[model samples]
Target: MSQSLLIFAKILSPITSYLNPNTKPPTIAKRYKGKATLKLDIPQGVADLLLKGVINTDTRTYECIVEIIGDEDGSQSDTAKLVVLVAPSTPVCKIAGVAEYGQNINLTCLSEEGTPSPAYKWQSHDVNNVPRPNPPKTTDKNGILSLYNISKDTSGFYICTSTNEIRSAKCFIILAVMQPPMNKVSTCVILAAVAAVIIFGIIIFFYCCRKKNKPEEYEMGRSDEAGGKQLFCCHGIISSSRCAVTPTNNV
Candidate 1:
């Protein structure tokens, strides 16, 4: 019987190599040391790749190679695919675009981790917690639910489910469509409040800066001896109402 050597490859990189030297069983690469092994008995006519604790990274193409020693035959190889399935992870729900009357928006859901790719489904419920039907002319496909010409009546809670062969996961969000005017008012209010905060912060920053870098006090008003009205300036911290008028009198 002609002796033979076998090699296992993950995209041409050998994980384990069995040589005809007959000195040892098989040499497994350090990276795959404890994770992979070969069946010693080749009499079974098939080389079996035994693996343990397989993970998602193990999903890839695998090739088994055989070479007959000292023969005209060079080497023969067979290829196969290994796919590790993972259950869907918790999905994230999101809303895109403004939620307001007569507006269009999209509700999105996604699972970060899943094998074979997870499919998505959306369910709607009224504010009263009662199940409701998808809006007419609505498009729900590929993890996105599109709502066109939405109104206050379109406000509700939406649930999205991500499913795969391994398992399923779910996430939800509440949509409260408001009137256009109310939405604009709310936005303006938020902007105004933010602007006020920023302005206040700037004033405080300049005040503290000047407090730390106070310059020498020099004459800033006209002398009474010059017959000009001596305008005394009320110097205060930045933003202090007392400093509303800056003295422009000639010194």
Candidate 2:
């Protein structure tokens, strides 16, 4: 009689769990660790989620088993999907005005659209070019960035990152400060005053020109030789000689 050799194989179902409470749960990959051997005792739904690209791991307790499926040759396959979670979605910042030395600055971050709440952090290009003081500002609860009364030393590029095991987003904020001797508000006022003075001078010049062009007037009076007789007109209509003889004494 010849001896017989046999191989034993076990088939297991997939892992299906709710990754997010509000959104549809993601599907896990079918093969984990590039293995084709299926485990026994996998649930029907869980087996499907595993094939879709999800890794089963109890984040809170880490009790879930990781299953890997391989091909006929037993070579590892690339069908499993694992997601890393980081928070705050679409983080960005804007400058209210020119960031100047010793000026109070405001920086805000928003992450309302992310699956999981994101977080904020401030960074600068250090002398050695290293990212230091990671997580300059963060909240353990929610994602909201608020920086009030900022100073010149705080001027630099900031990064806002959002991740939740499935998807991620990033944004950068550049802070620049300018300290000039001239104040912006005072410069505007000075320019306005100079303009007003120039306008007033122009108005006075036009008014004087109008006054000089006015017509002059002269009053007509009787000549002394006519003895109260009317003065002679240029056309001789009222000549002194044409007066009545009552002025004969003058003649």
Candidate 3:
């Protein structure tokens, strides 16, 4: 039994060593071209293998495959294709809000993401049944739609269509016409005119009453100033000279 165990131990030690040889670590091979460059890293132990011809870095303008070697029979390999895209992304269009009548309404369409700069087209329709004949006019360099001097006729549905070479999107806003506040202003003017007329009539009536009572008031004042009140007498003076006076108890 001791001899059998010794033989088994010796056989397992060689098998383990044979299975675990000096293995090369995995690596990444990259190829770059133009203004853009591709970078790759191989582990320290396997980096020497990449420096050798084991890893192919020789393709037109930097293309290669990483070949991994180990104690195993077959060497595994991987291909790395590196593409550099420097173009910008496409922008998105959105309708922020709409403006009402008699207001400076602003409609905004913005790109959430993009590079080559998206373009904007603004179209509007009115209730008059006629389509907006003209093409959408660009409002800003940054794609902002400013509807200035809004009026009743200016109220309508506005559409902002944004497009890029790859994709396109549209957004819209419905602008309502706000009726000018007529009742308040008209009622105020009317009330003011009515009050003015009422005030004028009151003043004129008092002035006329005062004028009508002026003669009677003046006569009463003069009579009060005279101090001597007299009664009406129809007889004239009977005797100018001194008259004899008679006092009699029986006559």
Instruction: Please report the candidate that would top TM-score against the real structure.
Output: 1
Ranking by lDDT: 1, 3, 2
Query: What is each predicted model's overall lDDT from 0 to 1?
Result: 0.86, 0.45, 0.45
* Model 2 worst lDDT window (10 residues): 1-10
TM-score-superior candidate, 1 or 2 = 1
Alpha-carbon lDDT of model 2: 0.45
Kindly report which residue stretches of model 2 are placed more than 4 angstroms away from their true locations once superposed.
Answer: 1-89, 96-98, 126-129, 134-149, 184-251
Model 1, 157-229: lDDT tens per residue?
9999999999899999999998777777899999999999999999999989886676543334434566554
Question: Candidate 2 residues 19-115, lDDT tens each?
Answer: 2122332343454334322233323323222222322331122124332333233322123333334444565555445466544445555655543
TM-scores, each model vs. reference: 0.70, 0.31, 0.38
Query: Native-vs-model 1 lDDT?
Result: 0.86
Per-model RMSD to reference: 15.4, 16.8, 20.5
The TM-score of candidate 2 is: 0.31
Task: Count clashing residue pairs in model 3.
Answer: 3
